[model samples]
Target chain A: MTTASAEKTAENGAGEEGYNFAYLDEQTKRMIRRCILKAVAVPGYQVPFGGREMPLPYGWGTGGMQVTASIIGHDDTLKVIDQGADDTTNAVNIRRFFARTAAVDTTEVTAEASIVQTRHRVPEDPMTEGQILVYQVPQPEPLRKLEPREIECRKMHAYKEYGLMQVSLYEDIARFGEIATSYSYPVMVNDRYLMSPTPIPKFDNPKMHDFPALQLFGAGREKRIYAIPPFTKVKSLDFDDHPFEVQQWEENCALCGAEDTFLDEVILDDRGGKMYVCSDSHYCARRRAEGHRGTLSDSAAAAYAAAVGAADRPSEDGESAEWVT
Target chain B: MAAMATLAGSAPGGIDTTDLKPGLADPVHDSQRVFRALLEAMARPGRPLQLEEGLDPPFPLDPATAAAVLTLCDHDTPLWIDWIADTPPVRAYFSFHCGCPLVERSQQAAFGLVSDAENMPRLGLFAQGLDKYPDRSATLVLQVPSLSEGLAVQLSGPGIDGRETLRAAGLPDWFWNDWRLNAAQFPLGVDIIMTSGRALVGLPRSIAAEG
Candidate 1:
């Protein structure tokens, strides 16, 4: 049989012979594929699905992984990040899994990747039309607080019954001087459906509007998936009296000296030594390559390399087998 | 429309357990099918849903709806039972089947299941949705002994263009009164589904309770 026919045969069956490509069955992929098309058509609308269990836990990046697995093909280049760092433990593990199963090419640069699975931050590079950003969402509902029932939420979406959401925001203005939401601020997608940008800082909210890339939000535990297609209109919810604003810290990324990037506060030692760093690891790495270095990067990288090198080293007998835990 | 393709045969008509997706074990697959049917019934208010099989549930709740609770609830989901009205067998079965913990009060439950609506707690007891995003609300599953045609309540809302009435037997008079107040909490109040041994009817928060 030709290679193409063999590949097609494997695609029709789950884990047939030697393939478990991404560990999801083709039927499940077909289901997710259907959901994606509907999401793209409705743009910014949430569609409920029978989300399956992965080998990984729910809180971890399972949702994003599922989305990646569904859309990832032989030709795709994948990139995964946690807290914006590609080398972070969770990110490393996910990338390694994809490499083993799907044998897809991996990239560290944002612009080079066709599919990027991310948590917490959007990349500094403006995404082009061909790229897809899959977000790991813990909570997918924008109106979960008002109507706990999935049945009710469906009705609200059908009729555009959203008065209760308005009341909650008005209350926020009443209590705080402004809308107190910083991270995970709710936004209206395409002026038709309300969506959560998956806990990305409000700084990323504006970037969501009319973006060139397709954005997919998956909340596995919540059993919901939502999307924002290329050039879709997204507006953060706010009143005329108090407009929406992104959260800004007084300090810049100490390493990059960049004020526009979202900063992650790193506490050094017990003395409460505070330093701000760019949350996006690629952005931070680029800054360092340009001769910008934070106080902690050198120490952190040295410790990390030593630990990994030791873990990878061969034993005295030259046998590569790792000891049982 | 593509998303609805796989779900078409299973939606309005109750799912056949034998025809379920391969590799799914009993209870999980059956419950999933029933839950989807229930969700569809609730999505379209005043519509009655069919049960493919009898549930033979422990006590207080029927087998069909029990299957729904088992499929939907988990450790992450919060469940509220009628005040001291639900039986021990029912509670134990839910804990075993769904792994869901009991809520101390009605307001806290993601799902509120009531066996008796006559002496039911106030509708205000359930959590209401906030103003900014009103979708966060509780789902109430009320178990009535029988379903009939007389003295039913009319439902008209997002899914229903004209008035539609559903007969749910064995409910208290004050139930509608409490539901009236619950409807006022639209985006904030609870969504209710009244179930008998074989039939189901939904009352979304969007519906206005007739006086």
Candidate 2:
């Protein structure tokens, strides 16, 4: 058998033989679990942890992977999303990695997933209770860029001194006539710690507030983990007069004609060609399956057939592990 | 050779008759499930979840408490226990399953167990942690009578939506006031996990409640 064939995972069989369950040792998982419990206890407060080296690099969702590995059980259904697209290489690779290592069933449907590990964007679908959302955070501190010192940041957090973050927002409003931060927007968690919502676009910030699902953030490189419990208040920083506003697009999705979801601008070609599509590819596919179509799509019937077809779950036939969506 | 050939699963007079009977049936998967339940309980403060089932602990020990101890505790964690949980059987169970050091003083403990809620120590007695490292505080596994029925208190804070009703029974009258003082400490207080037979509710420092 070829190396590639040996690597292919068809179902929830025993994963790679050498590695422990979920690729993390029992001791490491315990330590990370301790950090996780602490993170959940103090909502949005970055709890320092002893970071471990992963198979992948630091920034490429290692932190989120660590959290997912620690919390994932045998019965869990895993989902991985990079920028909300399930078909992306990073998303597919991570999904494959977990499928092979942990021997857990993986899916692309946002609602069906028990643990959704994501980078850059939250799923467009509403996350209900019992669903755990793990975010890949580059930096856990919201005040890091302003105050580089760790001790000062901890002191500020201890004393409830969040004026520096507010001042920075004020500076943005003064220059751009609004809070200019498009992604990784600063949010006050439970009206306490100012938290970085993991580089997700500002449009997804409101979804964090009063969300029914537990949200966990992990910064592997920074050796920190934080969390926002379900039903918690996560408010984006803005003035009363200015108010916090999400980015709005006049263009609909180029593939599924979604007018409400966060749109991603796609470059069609070199000759000044571009089209706006839903950043959440899973939601876009669902829309297409429900008969929504755009100018780029072939037809509504074709889109439906392409979406809710045999390709959506290819592992049932025992062939390719590439994500269809 | 005589001591070595004694027995496999239990001591001469161990509470747990079998070694495997002390902890979860399956450590890897069971810990995951228990922790998931615990994560949910922590995320939603007022709501009580059926944490674990079918656990036979020593006298006065709740199954939910045993489940948490088995899943979360290790040699690194120092656990402080009250008289109810300080019995010989209970100590043997912890030694066999958890192996966590049982500390006499609450302040030195990273975790605490209070089977006697009425006589539980003051919230300040447990480690409140340092100002800079508030997460270093202790997490008390407080065994209560019933999480479903009790004094209907209002809980509003980080984890709560607008306002939530928590009905915890058998708690002292000074429970709410003591919790209030604890909350006033803000990033420096011990978190509580109230447990009954098979149910538990997490009361993290982020919550503020009044009866």
Candidate 3:
């Protein structure tokens, strides 16, 4: 759909010549490319850039979209996921957005994609050197909580100051007995620039350090873009007594019976009935296809089918899945 | 991550200013260029930089300097302010234009506006990068009261060939002494910018103060 329109725009001989390959205009792409180059040069350094407004909202993966849009060309394959599910509405919409704008090929398999825009979790599969991961950061400043002022933070960055961050962590331990921030925690990138991993779980934080893929962050409403180039080091802010830890689940996935994947706990009934499922849809599906089965696969499938049936049944306003479980 | 679908919905490179938010309508492009100039100024210290046109704010901050912050800061980057000039209009302008969060404490800011040099906090209170890596220093955007002929001080440091004197205004002697100590930290000191309307001067982390 996007290909047709892009071709139409091209055929119409839009604006000046030497514009960018897609519609990003050469200067914009050049600026983004320059930032990417700097990010690559200084791995894990959050090189700030002038972020532009996309035809989308702020929180909904605009950063990843911008990075992807800047890097993508007609030949590249794109993959987008949200909560590890490609079929999820946001993922589908983002995929559609890129398809329409850049006119690039879209894929679901992680390995095949040249660029992947992700929210929450990194893929279970290992990322390669060629790929780039663009994260959607809600907040980019790590010292934001410790120091609220941009002027102060800039002074901090300029002066190489970070004592307050340590003080805040110590206070957190003194009060809560643990660092209260569960996800989207601050990690020092390349031991220099402070970066926000965009609310991805702690499980994904380790994956960020020493990763082969180039990592980029964009916060549209905030108008900031930072990056972690390939091979950069990333470390979660922690102390000797308080080591960084991923979320641990006592039970295996109810769908794929996998113990390693992140699990989503579901309450089956008011009487403490419960089930757990692998949050990575692709991984879960692959496991099920490979003869892996869990205690509730059959029942869950039935329940899902019943829910779909109920939705398909026309109601007063023709709404479907309005109240999803 | 998924690749973009196609090239259909991509808007033109530049949006119409009339269509843009009032704060953002006219300045995105020029703001970007000027911000780049500021970055370049820091990347190589002591270099005088020129700003693009179309930026003018009220007293306290020079237009070019204000333009630099407007380009980089948003509601996300908090400002540590030393003094308040037209509070309502300034706040409204920043919120509407840049959407930058304002911070009262100097230590917590990403950028700071030091209106009064006499009342400026100790430089050590701001961020200095950690031991292993030290480029984490802060960037100070100082608005000096005046920049006149022969009102200068000598500078010496990494970026300078030798002793170089440049004119500046409204900074205390303690500020320079502290800056020298800050520069002794090498890759861990703050960068400074002193500006009037169209003209501006920079002192990157590399510059050391000389008597």
Every model's TM-score: 0.54, 0.90, 0.56
Compose the digit string of candidate 2's lDDT tens values, residues A1-325: 0013234354545467888878888778877887898889888899988789999898888899999999987677888888987766667677777877887777777888899999999999999887999999998888899999999999999888999988998999889898899998999887778899999999999999999899999898998999998888889988889899999988888778888899988665699988787888779878877878886757643553355342243333223334334
Query: Candidate 2 at A18: error in angstroms?
Result: 2.7
> CA lDDT of B152 in candidate 2?
94
Q: Quality of candidate 2's docking, in CAPRI categories? A: medium
Candidate 2 chain A least-lDDT 10 residues: A1-10
iRMS, candidate 3, in Å: value is 10.4
- Which of candidates 1 and 3 is the stronger one according to lDDT? 1
* Per-residue lDDT of model 1, residues B1-211, tens digit only: 2355455633223322222222213542354345445544553567677777556675566654565566556766688888644555566656655557887788788788887766777777787655433444566787777666546777665444456677777777777887787766454567777777767776666566574
DockQ of each: 0.02, 0.66, 0.03
Residue B102 local lDDT, model 3: 74
Best by DockQ: 2
User: In order, what is each prediction's RMSD in angstroms?
Assistant: 15.9, 4.3, 15.4
Scored on chain A only, each candidate's TM-score is 0.84, 0.90, 0.84
Residues A1-325 of candidate 3: C-alpha lDDT, one tens digit per residue: 1122222233332322344334465446546644543344333345566677776788887767777766665556777778876656667677766665555566666888877888777888788866767777778777787788877886676555777877877888999998877788778865656667888877778888777675767666665666664445589989988997778888888767898987877677899988887777767766776878777657775575344232122221111224356
lDDT (Cα atoms) of all candidates against the true structure:
0.67, 0.82, 0.63
- Let me know the TM-score candidate 1 reaches against the reference structure: 0.54
